[model samples]
Target: MSETIRLPHKPDAPLSYQFVPGQGPLSTTHLIVYLNGLIAPQSGWRATIDHLRRRWDEGGSRSANHPALLTYDRYGQGGSARDPADDQHGGSHDIREVVADLHVLAQEIRRTKMIKDADASNEDDGAAAADQVPKPKLIFVANSIGCVIGRFYAQTYPGSTAALLFLDSNIANSDQVSLFPDPDAPGFDPHVLLPPDSTVADLRRTRAGYAAHFHPSAPNPEHLDRRNIISLLPLSDGPPLRGAEPDEGTGPRITVVGHDWATFAEEGLRGSMNVPEGLTNRYVNPPWAAYNEGLARLTSADRARGPVIATGCGHFIQKDDPALVAELTDDLLRNIEADSAA
Candidate 1:
């Protein structure tokens, strides 16, 4: 039967998770913990699960060995434990805490029995029977900032994660901020990045102009939880910087991105520009520059790994083309296995 697993986040407190075990007997040698993207839990992962189910049936014996899928929200979202401090930029909200939670979930899965067919005539498998089932290899399927958290975990706990499936994500060390005038730019900022005299009108006009261009993969506004989007806002007031701890190790990582929106927009839209004038390069550059640089550092750490490009998508690849995400996830998990075998 499906269940919930709680892990200690702060002392005397626990983080709650919804654990829906896959139907059928446990047959896979790997377990995939899918991390939800920026907004909230219960968003953007159904397509992924459906894709996996179809593949499991189609691929026959080969797919029968596919990993079990586990998905959970971060501490603040969904049923997870709340963080006392709402400080966006603090270590509490840092990628590390997210990583630690995944670790706890992984350990809990290791201890549990396979969710045997609910209709079976058999009783509990018992400890002896449970011991016979092999330990499931762990893989993390992450998106957006979730990818960043997974990357940190793999680097720190290298042996634990079999692989990472990064969908439309930034994997580099976000060290420095640069200016890019367009507000629609992936990492663009308006207020601090722009000049002092830049009016509120400038900010509103910039956001509106960009909003026209901000076509996420899934256009449904319901998919986003705007109330909890504080995490996506920049942690630091200024352009965010890449902060690397002393011992980041080389770990296996992979990235998948949808078609380049900026290039597409430049080509598709006609010449009349609606964005505010005098928006300096300074304002536009910092976030993307920092995030892109961080992505570079991550990819460089392991050349054999890749930043795989997915076709035809805006920011939310999970919503736009979940089939692509699933296909890529399969390949990524296989690669992780291959690396381990090698």
Candidate 2:
């Protein structure tokens, strides 16, 4: 399914994607786009997609209400071409530019009949399928930095996003390392929350790892001043975030999901670096919870509802437990459909 199909796009930087046409009435069909973690490839979503496809087949075959599925590699990731403009811009892309690529890709998918009824013709002409039904609405199912991209995408293209399911978004607007307790800062107490085996060296190593992988724009795939976006879309306590189309009915019904505490400490932090479980529990978890909570409140509908904890999973919830992600996605779709009917 992952191929460089040469979908007519900017010749210099054509992205790669895996798209599956859906069955049933195409008018009701949604384009379920999977946005992978910052550095993770689109293939990371295989398990979740397969499980969701199975659920899509629950009622029937030819008349299944499954949404069209898509997963793509962003510029400089996986099989996609690199942004020629990156070198001029200090070898990183702006978050806004990355989202613009997504918008172009989505429009191309529709214009090229990428999401359509395949069985409408024997030859399976995409144009014929397109002639039969309307283009699908966008429903983003994103993870980590992908969630960041999704938000920008929705904002840029008003009324395009029908629903969103954010799977453990990154703590945007953060240095990520600063959230941890430093060993040398003012009034630093090493003995306070240290684990039995962890020492100052361990803490330093953890910070090093964080800095190497997660500093602002150096290692960050996109130039995301995450704080700015969060400020722009700060919860539904105020009026609609910035670009909300009043006609889009509450604007993108959003659901947030996050990793379990224990698993995240073990796999997300410790597995990657020398981070102590104590620091992770005390320092990182609270801020992470607050971040996801804030994300859930971006839209009016999901404001009161907190993030759905992925009890057995780590940062990569889909890989840890695909079934749960699939179930949540199916549930969100049904909710969106019901709202449309209402």
What TM-score, over all chains together, does every model reach?
A: 0.61, 0.85
Pairs of residues at least 3 apart in sequence or in different chains that clash in candidate 2: none
Summing lDDT over every window of 10 consecutive residues in candidate 2, give the lowest-scoring window. 236-245
lDDT of 2 by residue, 5-34 (tens): 443445666677888776544333568899
**Where does candidate 1 stray beyond 4 Å?**
1-3, 8-28, 84-92, 113-126, 129-136, 170-172, 175-177, 181-253, 262-306, 336-342
Q: What is the C-alpha lDDT of each candidate?
A: 0.51, 0.71
Best by lDDT: 2
| TM-score between candidate 2 and the true structure | 0.85
The lDDT, on a scale of 0 to 1, for candidate 2 is 0.71
Q: For candidate 1, give the lDDT of residue 278.
A: 39
